[model samples]
Target: MNENNGITLSIQKKKINDDDDDDDLTGCFKRLKKRKNRKVKKKEEEEDEEEESRRDIDNLV
Candidate 1:
């Protein structure tokens, strides 16, 4: 019985360690996704500004 309990405890500890590693991986992915979103938004804003400037020039001409 005692040997069985020790084996069970070790298994539980291994499961906990695996869960922590999964959490870390998800966190890293979240940060990378956020950085990608920021870059996309910046690019869109730049494109809009360029389009507006072109319109202004057309009106002046």
Candidate 2:
């Protein structure tokens, strides 16, 4: 009975450690997603600015 309790406790500890690892992975993925979104948004803004500049030049012509 004592040995069984010890085994159960160890298993529970291992599960806790695994959960922590999952949380860390989730955080890493969220950060990566945010970075990708920022890059895409920046690219879109740059394209918009270029389009606006072209329109201005066309008007001048």
Candidate 3:
């Protein structure tokens, strides 16, 4: 699995040896990724708002 960013999943064949581990792992990974994206977006927005607030305060001074 390449961890260079984005969802780079490698799915093997679902033989008898392949249980629900792959499927479950993939699903969990997707969920975690979605949550991470949301968190990153929120954090960026908060930072931007903070910058804007600082600018406003500076203008008032």
Per-candidate alpha-carbon RMSD to the true structure: 1.5, 1.2, 14.2
lDDT values of the candidates? Answer: 1.00, 1.00, 0.80
Superposed Cα deviation of residue 29, candidate 3 (Å)? 0.4
Per-residue accuracy of model 1 over 1-61 as CA lDDT, tens digit each: 9999999999999999999999999999999999999999999999999999999999999
Clashing pairs in 2: none
All candidates' TM-scores? 0.81, 0.86, 0.65
User: Which ranking of candidates, highest TM-score first?
Assistant: 2, 1, 3
The total of clashing pairs for model 3 equals: 0
Q: Write the per-residue lDDT of candidate 3 for residues 1-61, one digit (tens) a residue.
A: 3564324233333342367777888999999999999999999999999999999999999
| Residue 6 Cα positional deviation in candidate 1, in Å, after optimal superposition | 3.1
Off by over 4 Å in 3: 1-19
lDDT of 1: 1.00
Model 2 lDDT tens row, 36-60: 9999999999999999999999999
